[model samples]
Target: MSIPIWKYALSMLTYFVVLLCITELLRKKYKLANIVWICSLLTFPLWLMGGVSGWFRWAKILSVILPTIVVGFCRIANFEERKGSFWEFFQKGWILWFVYGMLFLNILEATLKDVSLGNYANAACGFLLCATIPFAPKFWEYSKTGEGDLICYTTVGWNFLYTTWNLCFVYGESPNYFASTICILMAAELYPIFKKKPELYIMSRVYTLATHMILRSCFGTMFLKVMDASTWYNASFAKYWGILNFILIIPYLFWYMWQLHTGKAEISFKRGKTNNNVTTLNT
Candidate 1:
């Protein structure tokens, strides 16, 4: 229920805000809404400032900016932004951003004269992802003003899943329910956009608030006294944390499974008269 301290305090809070700034510069990066993009700038100290001092600040900053620059470069040339959603831009163009993080780690190892394949691993993934962007014409298409980037449910689903997975690994056992909650809620908003289920938008907000309250009450009664206020990533709290995160997201996960099932069962969209009959899926 509480925003994940690592996320709020770490890269997500900062990057969400900072990168939201970059969104203003892009053609249309804010999938949630322009208002949500503005709202992302506001964060609480309990979430962002309470973490383990400074970590991934630069990496997150660069992550937001590097891709924006790459995606926006095309726009600056002709005075129009790129032709993809924030996820698509980010989905396809995570190369230099990720590579930069890896390069930083690699350089750190080299600076310490350490030896390991960590740098190699970073380079490998970075190189592979980066290589495809140039050839991916979807990453290059330019649409008219009202015709924004076409949203894809499959792509958005992948992004959402990957984001959750990364958050789990990045936080380890002690996961931040707040960040994860907001992400799920936002992900839920996509259901309305893609599936014409705007009711989920309200449902997501209610669910997020309710979950946070429950977590707060439960944690304060059970584990808050024992939790390290300074850090959530510890053996002492990780199990409960991971459990809470998993429990907190069960609704969201179910939502994902349902969408996937429906996606397979029905054709989201098709041309001609089918367009009138078939639903259109969007990220």
Candidate 2:
């Protein structure tokens, strides 16, 4: 079935508006964001039963992990990045490394799912993406201000790779919902673009993903029912995207490692400025 351009456009527009609002509310206010954080945690089991993962084991894993990501990311945002605080301890402590671990688990879930579905090409890409995780912790810098100033300071290069990898994962897992899901992903990227703050990428992604998951839970057939959107799944479509993800990520991973080895990785501070000489992690 051919989906009209207008339908895609409308879906994109609707998601962009709704998600941007959710992101802003979560980003700009501490109390509200905290409320959402609490609510999301409390509602976790409900989300699992809310038609969230369907029959996909990967989706079930994601249903658990994503909300946890939201909570952890929010807690990182909740702490003031000043001296002698728990937040400071978290940044310095070994526990903070779990942040990266959680991220790796999230990616692995999708990769494993791709493998189970016989998406060999995408699974290969997913494993390659996982390989990049050890190198990833250095790329992100986290901080929060008074009220709601949770900032991740994610760089452009890293976010681009992540967004592309995730898009391919979604394509592999839920091609039938790709059109609508693309809107959510695009909206996530758009938040950073519109805000003119590249650091907002991860923050935007966390909230938008949470919001989309909630919507999916509550209105499982929203896109098809409300928008009259067409849905289809194709192995070739999934395979081609998986192939593309693999091809694109391999060179970038090599380049990333080269940068690290050469002591030239883009390391950003809280303000998002790059320090080329500093090899160790900077927060």
Candidate 3:
């Protein structure tokens, strides 16, 4: 793998680099590190543009339009004072970085072999994350930088949905590389909800998360052993991931119905606090 497992691990370390960028961009600390990281990330859009076709053309054009706005807004936002977790300032950046990082790995892997390594990468990620995610929160809170950070329900919900999709269809298979990275990235987002004593529904949440993790990990491993090396698709994909997701949806619906009847449920957004406080940030 051109993207060694080490590189995947190294990608996690980039969070610190983002921290340094925050520190330097605001703290005026580690200016050199900030410059290097910025320069490194800037190369990706160029690579995308060079390979431009249908979707890539739009990506390349959006790159030009979006970065200018992002840069301008960030600069203005920081002009007065920079307060909040590095995550608050750069929360969504990680997702974009993950997408770009996957693209980078795909290109690198293809350069060395006839096939794209994206599928393997996706499988490796999904397998690893599914195996480990249930343990991460018990180890430490991923989202709480200190305290008083806004609990963004949209963020965690997006991670759950996005990773779920990726697990089912990553590398267009049962487990995916993108799913793992996303699952790991989402570790922080859930911190807001769990910072307090566990609530009644929280049990359901953890159960669902654990269920999906085990589901993905088990299916991924099973498919790996049975799979033909020539094809990334398993004939059992529908039987495995499709059926598994269907099974898991039962609990979500249960939670939804119960919460709905209680008048405490919402379609989007929930805020949690360290004091066992449940506040509605959005309905």
Candidate 4:
């Protein structure tokens, strides 16, 4: 089937604009954020009643819920710097690892899907992508703001890799959804990249992904039909993406490991801007 290029372009732009607007609002308005958070939580029961069950659906729920929890925790704890608060102990001592672990699990979900699909090359790429994550508390430190909290590890390079890897995963696993899904990815990156605030990546991603999933779930038939700009997939296409991801991730992962080994890891690929906790290893 042929995709209408103009229609796809327009749709992508529309989704990007809408997601950015919602994310910006959530970033500024705590009450509104709470409302959206509650609605996102409610989707779980709705999905259950509607008989929605899948790793991806659960992942989507967790994606929204977990980030909302982080924001809420940041708001309640309200500590400036790492004061010796019990909340700080809870957050840094265990919550950090928990968050990172959940993020890793999300990535692993797609990796397993690739493996099950017999796309070994993409599966290996997924594994390598997982390896590159800096799961240490140092890397997962929270940055609190008046609006909410965000993790500091999502640098430009890391965001690029993640967006690419996730895009590849979607294209391989659900090619029909790939077109609309890309708009969400793009929306996640645009504001953060433009503002040079990589820490906002997770927040933006949560808003975009949660909104997309909720809309898609509620209106699957119409949503797919409208966004069905392209619907063709082939083994060769998946293989190409698999190899491409490997090519992009391998050296990047090696460099990250080397930085960890040398005890000089900078979160951003660009020089002169290192994380405050970069002196410590991510082990």
Best by TM-score: 4
Q: Write the residue-wise lDDT of candidate 4 on 27-128 in tens digits.
A: 677556757776666666556665457877677667657666565555344434435565464444566666677667777888888888877777787787
Could you estimate the TM-score for every candidate? Answer: 0.33, 0.78, 0.36, 0.82
Candidate 3 lDDT score at position 42: 48
lDDT of candidate 4 vs native? 0.68
Per-residue lDDT for 1-283 in model 1, tens only?
4435553555434423433233223324423333332333332233343342233432333333333344333222222333556433433443323433432442242222211212232223222222222112211222233323322222333334323433433344223333433344444445345545232232222223233332333342233332223244564343343344445344545554564468631232111111222112122
By TM-score, how accurate is candidate 3? 0.36
Question: CA lDDT, every prediction?
Answer: 0.33, 0.62, 0.34, 0.68
Q: How many residue pairs clash in each candidate?
A: 8, 0, 4, 0
* Native-to-model Cα distance after best TM-score fit, residue 214 in candidate 3, in Å: 30
Off by over 4 Å in 1: 1-56, 76-135, 138-140, 147-157, 173-283
For model 2, residues 121-172, the per-residue Cα lDDT tens digits are 8788778767765434455444433333334554455566677777777766
Q: List the residue pairs that clash in candidate 4.
A: none
* Order of candidate numbers by lDDT, starting with the best: 4, 2, 3, 1
Model with the higher TM-score, candidate 2 or 3:
2
Candidate 3, residues 1-283, lDDT tens digits: the string is: 1334554455445532342233223222223323433444444444443443454324433333344233323332233234565424532334323323332333233222211333343343333333222221111122222221222232233345334534444434223334343433343233323344222122222222322233233343332233212233464652355345444444554554565468553332233334233211110
| Candidate 1, poorest ten consecutive residues by summed lDDT | 270-279
